[model samples]
Target: MTRYEFVARAHAEGYSPPKEVTFAPSTRSEPHTHDQLSFVYVVAGTFILNTDRAAPAYQPGETCLLDANVAHAEEAGPQGATILVARKSGRVAETG
Candidate 1:
């Protein structure tokens, strides 16, 4: 989806306004947990997301939603990655 669409959807889902984040080439983050839900939209390059269940590569136009307190790590691809992130506190709503 386009950035505009992503922002609109995120907001509709109760996410806060997005903030732009850029990761350096090949950068890696230690495993961590967030107090709030995280909504990430890959804007450029690639983002490799690691979690207990899986590790997936997210390319531009892809999105990832992480639940509150979930353990996760991230790595930037060789070309690095730029993403838009939004957050929401409390529990996320259930979907059918």
Candidate 2:
């Protein structure tokens, strides 16, 4: 199995304001919400993502978006998943 590595960045490849957060194998996020409009691009591997509104399966190059105040969670595969997350920073805004 290949080891997974997560690279967290506030901005990547011209991804400004909202940045891309890369994740590794079996990476997870606590049930949380974001203030600004945010989303993710699955760079590699498979992952499961759950939110108040949906639970989606993501593959490489998949995209996800959520509004503020919405509870969300995630877990990647055994080999881990790579996620590029983009969101707003500073204040908590919006609601579930």
Estimated TM-score per prediction?
0.90, 0.61
Per-residue CA lDDT of candidate 2, range 43-79, in tens? 7778788887678888875566566567788878777
Residue-pair clashes per candidate, as listed?
0, 3
Best by TM-score: 1
User: Model 2 off-target regions past 4 Å?
Assistant: 1-24, 88-96
- Flag clash pairs in model 2: 21-85, 25-80, 26-80
The lDDT values for all models are 0.92, 0.62
